[model samples]
Target: MGRTSKIVTGGLLVCALVAISIPVGKEVVPGLFPQDQSSTVTTPAAQLPPAALSQVASVSELSPDAPLPDAAALSDQLKEALKYDGAGTVSVYVSDVLTGEELFSADGWTARTPASNQKLLTAGAALATLGPQTRFTTRAVTGSQPNQIVLQAGGDVMLGRDDSKPNEIMGHAGIATLAKKTAESLAGAPGPYTLAIDDTMFTGSTLNPYWPTEDVAAGEIAPIYPMALFGARYVAGELTGPRPHDAPVEVAEAFAVALERAGVETIGIITRSKTPEGATELGSVQSATVDEQTQYMMQWSDNYVAEVLGRMVARKLGEPVTNEGAVYAVRKSVRNLGLPMDTIWTVDNSGLSVSNRVSPAQLVQYLNILLKNPASSAGQELKGLPIAGLTGSLSDRYIEPPSWEAAGVVRAKTGTLNLVTALSGYVVNSDGRLLSFAMIGNGLTDGPAPLRTVFDNAATVLAKS
Candidate 1:
């Protein structure tokens, strides 16, 4: 029979099995079978309980042998859902992950503002260049002069002011823990020591010139620093509000306070200086692995973490660890995946800049490349994407209505701006075929919420296909 016919037949067989497993007047406890009595119906050697039947159905639903969704039907459904009346235009692209076949396309090749969706490219480059297992290090060492100590930045902006929490991504490396170690190492050796900060790891402007000044004041992002507590936020665990413009200096002050608490006397004034060559190491702490940080970045759409990852990617490639270097590294890495670079324009690693331009087709194509090899570095980046209605920025989304059907089944990255909304990721359709898609709405005069819903609805269509 034809592929679609085979799928229909198999689906009918599964329904029959389920219908026969439960007899009349028997209460089925969801996944469990009726335990009161055995049915008189005789057929197969053994019948599966509801739970086992569910497992079988799930396995079959994801089976590689399952049929693909009909392209024409999927196209019509998506076209209807993508229609918007408010203001802006919407672009969408969907493709079969296994065969690289384009299933749906609507203005997919047109470049538009990507917003935070740019984080996906940054995440991919970081994993490909730095490896997921790599961890950034923050070090405390003896300075050139007597009674001098240097706090060296190592690209870990997620440091905690308190003791390290082994379980967390934000505070995996704690300043207090490092201070204790440093105090112990310097026991009986000094009185008051001058603390210096070496934040030269990242070169060039700390803040992106392309970002709006008001956005920075509103805590959309802060100056990029090599080392920071709570990703440069003024307070730990607080994701929004005003941020310190001099994050490195704030970190140094915190370190000085931590040193005093650990029984080491500090001179109070923190200086900016490079660590002396061959300086004696006092103590150090390592941040969470790049994989963990990337997951956190994707889940929360963290602009700070995204930029840091990009700079580190530049460092790995021996490129200048500046904003320009980070951008170049990200674009180069994505291009190396064999994607066309002519259509993609990125001024900053974090998609906070309206100048950033990326097409829906490009995102879907990139996702397909990652899906092809699950074990590759670029492939591992997919694991960090936010799950619909379940995690990160999407926790409150996909919780209602037709879009709710995609909850827990869709894994994607969300992007937002005053007039732009975007979603890009992958989902396994009801037919068991893996599909990658990207939806971007720009110039939305009706506002972002409505356009966001449109994107969500489009994803739901793919899930139920």
Candidate 2:
């Protein structure tokens, strides 16, 4: 039997492991054992303290000598677990993180609608192109005309209406703070200034024509904008409902109101114009870091954030910054990572477009890349994936029996549409091997709960292996 060794680092662990062929077993490994610890050592679960009993194993505890899951047996188990009772077809791909070996694959090469899973690709591209430390700046500057103030839209769409909160992802920068700063800058200089907005950071259609208008009206998504208050929501903390069609104007109006409270009177009408060359800077605030924003995008599956990130990617790559540009930029960036972009099709950064097609294999391969060098900029993508039965979209899932066994061990990104569902991310298996998997279901006639169960059960099987 061949032996392999690898060092896993970044976001999770910095450890080395040596693999050898051995029979798979059911014993759980302590994720944080000392390096000199014996791989065969075991502590009965019943003998452990309650706190230790409740703790799930972390990746650091994995031993390279740990037996890999029997591929053939694992395939049999997954095939059975993946069986769906409804109409749709499911494609699955699972691989070992250490050796990049395919453990199980079922129709993995065939592309299917990825739904929100498309955001994974967008997240990768944005992280790679714009970098994890990058931040978008919204600035208030003197307009080309007298008594004119221009509000320039950076790439932040999650602006708060009140003071900026330094520790938050949403509203890291606030409109009211910007207004106060702008008011101070104009002290003893002017009154009743004309307010205007500059949103040229993005160009072309604000709304993706490929997305259904009904979905837009229902607030599944709104027209993409450079800046928005509470992520275009009418109320902060509300994830869904009617959203402003023109977010830039809305943010500017809020700024106007804030400016009035800051002792700077603003004209009632908010106009649209570009900041003049060499305009005097009045005030500016930055969005959260790209890493933080990406985490938020993944955790909540925010369509607006994903789309804006896509546009930002386009701008970085010198693309047109339109829907077409964003899609092109994402595909190109992912391809640059050496993944087979030819195998998948994407229409939008957010998987809201039903036309988007991605194979389970492609998704798994991407996860593998992230796992290989967890410290790289691309590795930051892993941090954004939602932990099962805990944070993000997976919070309510994997909490029930049969699936609960995998909770806290599986981290994944989820996608859901009326006819499509997808779950892709990495998991640390019972044998202590890190594994990446992707499951996508399409053409579904059944309700999503059943299909989600099927997917979760499959992931749970991986965790147990």
Which structure among the candidates has the greatest TM-score?
2
What's each prediction's TM-score?
0.87, 0.88
Q: What TM value does model 2 have?
A: 0.88
Each prediction's RMSD to truth: 9.4, 8.2
Instruction: Name the runs in model 2 displaced over 4 angstroms.
Output: 1-62
TM-score computed on alpha carbons, candidate 1: 0.87
In candidate 2, the residue pairs with backbone N, CA or C atoms under 3 Å apart (3 or more residues apart, or in different chains) clash, namely 31-61
- Quality of model 2 by C-alpha lDDT: 0.81
How far off is residue 181 in model 1, in Å? 0.4
lDDT of each: 0.80, 0.81
